[model samples]
Target: MSTAQLVSLTLAMLAGAVTLLGLVIVTGRALHRRRTRRDARLAADFRPLLLELTGGDDDIDEPLRRLAALDRRRWRAVEPSAISLLTKVSGHAHAALVSLFAQRGLARAALRDLDRFGAVRRATAAHVLGLMGHTEAAPALAGLLSDRSPEVRAVAARALGQIGAAEAADPLLASLAAGGGVPFHLVAQSLIRLGPGARPALAKALYHPEAAVRAVAAEVLGLTGAVETARVLIGVLAGDPSGEVRVRTARSLGRLGTPVCLEALIHATGPAHPHAVRVEAATALGDLGSPRAVPALCDLLGDPQYHVAHNAARSLARLGSGPAMAVLAETVAERPGTTAAGHAWEALAVLDLQAGQLRRPPTAPVS
Candidate 1:
């Protein structure tokens, strides 16, 4: 064949391929739109029945049994909206939804999907089981902590947290140690969800070799408000070699708001501590809202780190101490148009407003 003929054939083939691809794209979009409309209609149809189920209205057993009898595709269309109501309802309504989930064997289905190849599938399954609040699913969720995918691990951790199972605590801590890109904050939140039940495991984690683990543990403990953990956090602030851990500890101590924690926070603001630690300590001291921290906060107002100095000045003002107000006034006068000066002025305004509130007389009640 001639070169021109060959080129013409190739161009025609390429044009056909592109046209076919466009057709496929359009078809897929059409199917998706149809599916979305169907799901929306199903959701609307189910909304009243689900609301009645959650409302604890009479004769729900037949309606619930009818719902459970729905075909797979129809139920799939309704499931997302149904589960979404779990977060919206509470008390009898919540229990009824949980019963619905159980009766439909959703927990079992999700438990089976926990080991699915797709990360999205596994994550979705974990979420459903977690929201179901089924303790029987905890073991499966715990196993997903070691999943190869970081996203899967994170989702599983969150699921375990929502379950708030004491047994899941150790596995979650162990995952933190393994550290395959699972965020410290996510792990901390999960531990926090377990409340005091997770305290022992988190306390042990504070002694882990990795500073990240220790920091997470301290932060979670503070969030839990486990009063007994304050002493451990104070020790970390005083002696943990990692400045990051110390910073986290200082912050945790502020959340704990114990008298000893106040002492540790004051010591942390001292010049001997690292800049980051001191900055955290300054911020934490503010969180404590203690008059005792004023002198230490005043001293930190001249820190070399502008943030530390600014935070110290701001905290002092929040403390509403006479000493703090004087320090703020001095800072505003000494440095103009700087962060420290700005925080000082802001702090002064806050302090004055607080002072006004304190001095305001109680209004007489109408007879």
Candidate 2:
């Protein structure tokens, strides 16, 4: 063929391909819309039954059996809603839903999906197992903490927490180390969810090599009310090399609120520690609510760091003791125009406002 004829033929083929692509796009969209409508209809039909199961305190066996017996396609349509409600319901409703999921073999399917090649599939499976509160799935979920996908790691962390697996605490803490692909907050919350059962692991984590892990462990120990671990936290506050870890340790020590932590918190508030550590230490003194922290907190009221001084004043207010109030009153009366005085005055005002609110009579209801 002549060169001009060849060029024309190529252009015609390109036009045909473009037309075919347009037709495919339209057909795909049409199919997608049809599928969506069908799913919505199925969800609507199933939602009331699901709601009846989850909302009532009455017999759930019928609803449970009906839901479990749904055909494959119908079950798939309602499964997402069921999973979404898992965390929202409680007591009999929750047990019924979990039973329904188990009866449908969802937990087993989800466990299998935990090893799926697709990250989204793995994450979704982790979520489903978590909402099901599947204890058996804990180990596999913990394994996903080091998954290549951050999202998968996060889902697994959350699932382990939902399952209340105390053993997963260590791996969750480990995930806080460099490149663990999980957020520190997620791990901490999960650890908190594990509750006091994970205290041993958390205390051990206080010694983890990674500072981030150590820091989160310290923070969680206090939040989880692990009073027995207060001494370990005190040591961390006094000697941990990581400033962030020391700061968290101080706060945790305060939350632990043992009188033994008082000296360590006081020591942390001294000039030897970083200002951040001192700030948290001062704040922790307030949380400790010990009269012994009064002197240390009062001294902090004059620290060069505004936050240190401000938190010191606030903590003294938190103490809510005669001596603690006297210190604030003295600071306000004698240290006028200083940073200490300003914070002290603010603290006093807050206290007075609280007092006034307490004394004020409740308004009578309208006739």
Candidate 3:
């Protein structure tokens, strides 16, 4: 071989070896830093709020209370800590700020940092920006909806919802259009956060052929109290392929607070309704707070599924707490104390009745 060829081969091998070694070293340092950083960040972030919850930080409580009251200046005081608190992988500081960032100003700052120069920065930035409603960043975030990375796209969608851009409703609604193709949970959440702006697109989604999208649309409509969609869903309740969609329709009907919705919920609780659908339907009946739902709800006490039994029993107690207290007492007698029993007690509590202790009954008498 020529001398130049020999020299070239040797140089290539050395460069390849150097690259491999450098990658290994970088990976090791990254893993090591990650482990220690989590605890250290929490220790630093909470150093200021240590006394707020305990009521021991008299000096800090007033300021903490002021912050809790949605003070933007309070965040400026803890800005770095606030950002760290939001980005910290886990711990009490993160938990403490979950509700705080729901306020506007800090949410905007997070949106601003979403384009920060790294993955971790982007992830945390995406979370806070999507949840806090940064209207100003809507266009920039919308551009990221098509990001090559799935994580980036997902977070961008989330941030768009937080920004509550009416413009984003069309995109998110389109994602749910085919139902099977898009991520349904993320679409549902974004639609929900889009709130009033999403009502039009969500109403259209209600008629989508995809059962999942229709079901989610019904759920969002109910949550947002979209009374206008009631008539449209009623038409769908008759023959929609999925029982879940029909069940969601029943629940949304109940949310509309029309007396007609009670009948729809009653009809939906039949054997035709899936077990999970029946639970939501029954719960919707309770939210309706009508005397009419009591009998059907009472019948659900014997449902084979425990969740349905619980929801039905609770609904009956709500309508009958004053006159139906005996009925609820009887349900607890037959089934024993459970979540339904808890709701029954709470219903009684609302009726000005005292429930000092929950009672446990003897097992059924043997034949």
- Decide which is better by lDDT, 1 or 3: 1
Residue-pair clash count for candidate 2: 0
Scored by lDDT, the top model is 2
For candidate 1, write residues 1-367 as lDDT tens digits.
9999999999999999999999999999999999999989987887788877877786679768877888898898888888889878877787888888888888888888998899999999998888878889899888888888888888889988888898888888778675556777787788888878888988988899987788788888888787898887788888889988888888888888778788878888877889999888899998888888877876666567888987887778667647667777887777665566666776676666766843232233355
Residue-pair clash count for candidate 1: 0
What is the alpha-carbon lDDT for the whole of candidate 1?
A: 0.82
Clash totals for all models, in order?
0, 0, 2
Best-to-worst lDDT order: 2, 1, 3
RMSD in angstroms, all models?
Answer: 7.1, 6.2, 9.6
Error of 1 at 291 (Å): 2.4
Quality of model 3 by C-alpha lDDT: 0.67
Better of 2 and 3 by TM-score: 2
32: Cα error in model 1, Å? 4.3
Local error of candidate 1 at 67, Å? 1.0
The C-alpha TM-scores of every prediction are 0.83, 0.92, 0.60
- Over 208-314, each residue of candidate 3 has an lDDT whose tens digit, in order, gives 77777788888888878887777777766666888888877877877788776777778778877677677888888888888877778767766777788777766
Q: Candidate 2: misplaced stretches above 4 Å? A: 352-367
